[model samples]
Target: MLSYVRWYWPEEDRWNYDELDTDRWSLRHVELRGDGEVLAAASLAEALAARDSGGGGAVVTYERRFGVVPEAPFPPPDGDIEPVLETLSAGEFEQLWRHARNQLERAGSS
Candidate 1:
């Protein structure tokens, strides 16, 4: 499972939840594996810092699980992977930040 953090700016009154326009939103993906975990922690820390800086935007996090489809003839079936999103309270965000920061420090020492 890969964690993704995104910050949507300008705070729109209404949003089109049907689709994601990555070109306009600030996005970060964290891979929680091996050396990638260290980089992932750093990425999460960056997003947390931006959120804490009074950036006046909405910060959201989600987990994505990639799927593997069987090899098919020509036109393979669509293997759409939907992200699992969670709405976190302020305290939850703080806890996540603490955990990620700890991992980052541990990795740095190693």
Candidate 2:
């Protein structure tokens, strides 16, 4: 099982429970609710890096904690996303999510 996490808006300088998706072997989907608004959805690894990159000014960093994370279930992302980041489109995000699940299943030993 994967965990859901919330992130803050970097450029807008606002705090929102923005979400991210990570390669958790088995895709983990977290729907963030703001009173009742849907912010951007990102990966867990990106979120964490975005949080740290907040100080860079103007361009907020996207996708952090990647490339060296432990390879098991994967840890939750902090709140960062792609630079000049916008939420992933439904079709696009789902496609990636499905791919992650496929990888996890294939990696599993019968």
Candidate 3:
């Protein structure tokens, strides 16, 4: 199981979630979704710091089981992945998404 921290950005009406293995605090996955599109990070703190650097002022809600975020439609990402910044170009985003998915699948089987 994994632990995660969820953040809500009221200004953009979006949410970003990050997961890390509780024992080692190793970042496993990240998701940033707004209006249904997901942009998915680094370490938990590093990820949040990166976001904060962007000036969004997101508020931390709570930490809980990675896959059990209330009201979120999709299950948490499998370990061994990180999301690209939302500002990435379409082509870059596609490449990053594919890489992340491949990593996730590999992690699951190991």
Q: Please report the candidate that would top TM-score against the real structure.
A: 1
Candidate 3 overall lDDT versus native: 0.42
Model 3 TM-score is 0.29
Query: Per-residue alpha-carbon lDDT of model 1 for 34-55, expressed as tens digits?
Result: 3223233323334445457635
Model 3, residue 10: distance off in Å is 1.8
Q: Which stretches of candidate 3 lie over 4 Å from their true place?
A: 23-26, 41-110
> What overall lDDT, based on C-alpha atoms, would model 1 receive against the true structure?
0.33
Worst 10 residues of 3 by lDDT: 59-68
Count clashing residue pairs in model 3.
2
Give model 1's TM-score versus the native structure. 0.33
| Pairwise lDDT winner, candidates 1 and 3 | 3
Candidate 1: regions farther than 4 A off: 1-39, 44-79
Instruction: State, as a TM-score between 0 and 1, how close model 2 is to the true structure.
Output: 0.27
Candidate 1 global Cα RMSD = 15.3
> Could you give the C-alpha RMSD of every candidate to the true structure, in order shown?
15.3, 14.6, 15.1
The digit string of per-residue lDDT tens for model 3 on 12-91 reads 66665544354524353444556644434323454355446653433132122121223222233552433332333444
Q: Which one wins by TM-score: 1 or 3?
A: 1
- Name the runs in model 2 displaced over 4 angstroms: 1-84
Best by lDDT: 3
